[model samples]
Target: MQAKEAAEKLGITQRMLRHYENEGLIEIDRSENGYRRYSESDLRRAGRIRDFIATGFSTREIKSMSACLSDEGAGPCEGGVIKMQEKLEHIERLQADLDARKQAVLDRIEELKQGLAAEPLEL
Candidate 1:
């Protein structure tokens, strides 16, 4: 397949495909006319790359997961689970920080509401 068809099938833009290539995520062959040629393996790898990005994995992280990204059978790859756990832990920490901030904002709003109730409106 060509770049357009591959991009369409992957539900990503051609620019994203190029970006993935530039990121060294996948390698695409060039045709006689210098057009990009995507093989099934390439498309599968690109799809995995897209999935990893959607899950908030950076290209660097994905690069580190080369073992999991291979066309080999879908068995557990060493370090893949560790990487996912690390990402989950990172997200959990972020969620905790956001929760604390949200609680602070809510507490401030409640304090302001109480103050407004205690004060008489002066027009």
Candidate 2:
């Protein structure tokens, strides 16, 4: 299929396909006229890349899972599981930090409210 058709099917833009190719996530073939031609395997790989990106996985992390990204219908990749666990841990830490920041902001707001309540209103 052509780049446009592939991008449409994948629900991504052609530029994103090019970005994936540039990121070395998937390889696209060139037709006789030098236009990009996407094979079934390429589209499948691109879909995986898109899904991983949506799930917050970086291109570098995806690159490390090249073995699992292969077309071969192998069983579950243990390395992929490990990577997911690591990502989960990272996300949890970020969530904790965000929670703390949110609490701090809420506390400041409460303090400001109390201070305002203590001040007398001037006509």
Q: Report the number of clashing residue pairs per model.
A: 0, 0
Off by over 4 Å in 2: 73-75
- Model 1 residue runs over 4 Å out of place are none
For 46-95, candidate 1 gives per-residue lDDT tens digits of 98889889988999999989877767724688898998899999889999
Model 2, 1-123: lDDT tens per residue?
A: 999999999999999999988989888889999999999988888888888889889999999998767677234775988888898999999999999999999999999999999999999
Q: Rate the local accuracy (lDDT) of all candidates.
A: 0.90, 0.89
Q: Of the candidates shown, which would achieve the greatest lDDT relative to the real structure?
A: 1
| Model 1: ten consecutive residues of lowest lDDT | 66-75
lDDT, candidate 2, residue 18?
95
RMSD of each: 1.3, 1.2
